[model samples]
Target: MKRDSCQQRIYAVRRVGLAIDRAARATSKIDKRQAARWATAWGVACGVRQF
Candidate 1:
């Protein structure tokens, strides 16, 4: 089945979050939880609800 726009956007945001998380892990800058929080914040700012 085809996903909706919002789902696609969320998936993109998650991909970004994973990238950030991986980069941070590589550099030991931050943890996965922090990365997830940042992604959630971005999503909320972009008006993506249902979190």
Candidate 2:
């Protein structure tokens, strides 16, 4: 029973870790997309076509 509990704890920790990794990846993707949009807007404002 103790071993099973320990295994459960490990599984929970792994799930939490995976969730954090997924969140970080999602946030990074959003940040990258926002940066791209901002760059495009700035380029347009400056009349530059070489992005």
Clash pairs, model 2 backbone: none
Off by over 4 Å in 2: 1-3, 27-51
Q: Output the lDDT of residue 13, model 2.
A: 54
| Tens digit of per-residue lDDT, candidate 1, span 14-46 | 766665666467544456666756666666644
- In model 1, the runs with Cα more than 4 Å from the true position are 27-51
Q: Looking at model 1, which ten-residue stretch has the lowest summed lDDT?
A: 42-51
- lDDT at 38, model 1: 68
Local lDDT at 16 for model 1: 62
1-51: candidate 2 lDDT, tens digit per residue: 355755665655555455445555655777656555554554443444354
For each candidate, C-alpha RMSD in Å? 6.0, 18.3
lDDT of each: 0.64, 0.53
